[model samples]
Structure formats: C-alpha cells, structure tokens
Target: AERYKAANQRAVQLLEKCGTTQVEVDASGLLTYPIEKVDAGDQPDKKLKPLSVDEERFMRAFYEANVQEVCSAFEFPHKILATALQYFKRFYLQWLTCVYAACKIEENHVSAEEIGKGIKQDHHVILKYEMAVLQA
Candidate 1:
C-alpha cells in the first residue's frame, strides 16, 4: 500500500508536467509520440506481453537498484524514491523497456547514459539485457 502510494505520487508528478499517456523515443533518437497527440491515439499500437516468473524477479531487483541510484543521485525524498521505484516495477510488469523509457519521459531528462553514470551501472549491459528482460 505504501509503495503504491509512493509510486502513484511520482507518476502523478511526472504526468503533471509531461502529460498523461505513454510517449517514447525510438532507436533513431526520434520521439515517436507527441504529447499533444497522445489523447488522439497517435502513438503506435503494440500488443501487451505477459512476463515470466524469472522476468518478474529480475525486474523487481533491477527496479529496486535503479530507484536507489536515481534517488541518491537527485537527492529526492524517500517517498519519491519509493514512488519512482514502484512506478518502474509496475511499468516493467506490463512492458519491459518501458521503465527506462518512462524514467526519461516522466522525470527531468533522465537519459540511459546519465542513469549509468549516476548509478555506476553499465548502460551497455542495461541496453543489452533489455530484450532479455522483455522476454523474461
């Protein structure tokens, strides 16, 4: 319950500025969806995939660590950290790469590179495992 509240708050804060609905950047560094057109279903449609048990566990671990790193780097409140982490986990439950993409979309310009630098985590590893995480 507490985790949900935290996650909800962070998600709300992000949407307050970034707008509701999903937006993403493609591999070519082009933003695929515009916020103004979000309500119009201008974004590409993709099928929702279910996660395997192993994938769930890995995402849980990944989200927890990523949350700690992001909160520590930005000096955000514990609640915010908890919220962001929760958001990441929940998102990945439905979509794999969505967590990192959400972090970038919702938060203030969080890039994969910045995340790696802040957390001392390898960006290459994160990118490499993105597909595996999705498949898991």
Candidate 2:
C-alpha cells in the first residue's frame, strides 16, 4: 500500500537521523564507530575490569558474528541479539565466565549448567579456563 511505503521511507529517515545504522569498518581498514553519539562507559570507582584495545576489538567482532548466528537460529530481534552481545562483552570486561554464560544469556532461557550438561563439557573447567582465554 502507498501508506506502508510512505511509513517505511519515514522509518529509514528516522533511523538515519538517530544513527542506528550498522557499525562498519572503513575502506581504509579502520574500525569506525559511525553513530552520532557515543556514551562512554566512564565511571570511575566502578571496579570495572579493563580490556586491552585488541581484546576489546576482538570481543566485539567475534560476538557480533556469534550474536547474528544465534539470533538466526533462535529467531531473535536485533535488540535482543545486541543486548546479549553487550552482556557477553561486559561479563568479559570484568571476570571471565564460561563461553556458555554468554551463549546462555544471549540465547535466552538457557544456563551455563544446562549447556555444559548437554554438551558434555565440564562447567567447572570451562569457567576456569574463561579468564585465560580472555587474557590470551
């Protein structure tokens, strides 16, 4: 319908105004945050863990793909998918838990215990190795 087309066009304009477009690396091989506004996570004394620049980049890139894959399998929206990816990144920012924790939170209604049980991986070992993986 014409109305639907008009509304969709308006939505695209609004998204451009709000800078909700996809983040992309530039042609020069530089990672760029294209959004108009960035809220820095700059709270001193928050006891927040630090991630190295490389680690942060890797985490974002890796989780972005992982989130997309999981969302496709689970039929989730970008919002939920993005939230899970953020949670995974934040959890890694502090202490390392099992990759299962990230997958659980991102995928919904699953737990590290359940994943470990189903996959036959030691939950304890996975948790233990988490920090080292992040460090490496």
Candidate 3:
C-alpha cells in the first residue's frame, strides 16, 4: 500500500510535468511526448486519480500474464525464467523509490522507454560485475 502510494505520486509528478500521461507513437515507432504549459500552482493530488481495487487487480493479473508470455516466447528454461521473474519482482518493489529519487535529482519527467532502457543497462552492469567477481 505504501509502495502503491509512492508509485502513484511518482506518476502524478510525471503527468504534471509532461501535461498528459499518454505518449504519442510516430510512424517509426518513436514516442513523442506532448508539451502543455501546466500552471505552476496546479495541484497534482487533485488531478491524478488513484486506481480502484478492480483496476489494480486487473493490472496485476495482466502484468503476471505478460511476464509468463515473455518467458514462454523465448523458450527460457524454468530456472532461468524463475530467476528473471524474481529480478522483475524485486525491481518493481524498488521502482517507485528509484523513480522518485531520479525525478528529484534530474527534475525531469522520465518516460517509460527511458526507464526500460535504464533497467536494461542496470542488468548489463550487474552481469559484468558478476562476471568480474567470478573471475576473481
């Protein structure tokens, strides 16, 4: 519940900065953010709506199903899939914290693609560090 509140706050911050949460996809599959002048005094708390119980449940189910689909699509071994899923769960647990911290430090609205790329980069760094530790 606390994490959900933090995540909601982070999303509100992003929406307030970007004007809308929806991103435009171009013909080349590139995302373009819409720019609107939001009043500095605009209250995010009032503008952002919290997810209802049913919506939250649906989202959770959808995410789990998608994760399973991705694992199956790649024909990943059960052990490998389990490890990946664990990492994803752990990542999500910290996602709101990381995003909130990043927003404070950067003072910019981070896009979903940017967050995805950052996670992928972090995975690569972890793998490299693990390889180094194994070699030592």
List model 3 lDDT by residue over 20-129, tens digit each. 44444343435566855554357655465546545765776665565565445535455544544554454432222233223323444444344345445343222222
Question: What is candidate 3's TM-score against the reference?
Answer: 0.36
RMSD of each: 12.5, 16.4, 13.2
TM-score of each: 0.35, 0.32, 0.36
Off by over 4 Å in 1: 1-66, 76-83, 91-99, 128-136
- Global fold similarity of model 2 (TM-score): 0.32
For 1-136, candidate 1 gives per-residue lDDT tens digits of 5665565567555544444444554444344545433322234353223344456567678767756766676665565555556655554532223445445435545566766676576665445434433333
Off by over 4 Å in 3: 1-46, 93-136
Give the alpha carbon lDDT tens digit for every residue of 1-136 in model 2: 5664565567556544443433433324344666544222333343223344555567677756755665555465566666656655555431223243445445555554654565465555445444433343
Clashing pairs in 1: 6-83, 7-83
Q: What is the lDDT of residue 38 in candidate 1?
A: 38
Score candidate 1 by lDDT.
0.51
For all candidates in order, the CA lDDT equals: 0.51, 0.49, 0.46
**Considering every candidate listed, which one attains the maximal TM-score?**
3
100: Cα error in model 3, Å:
23
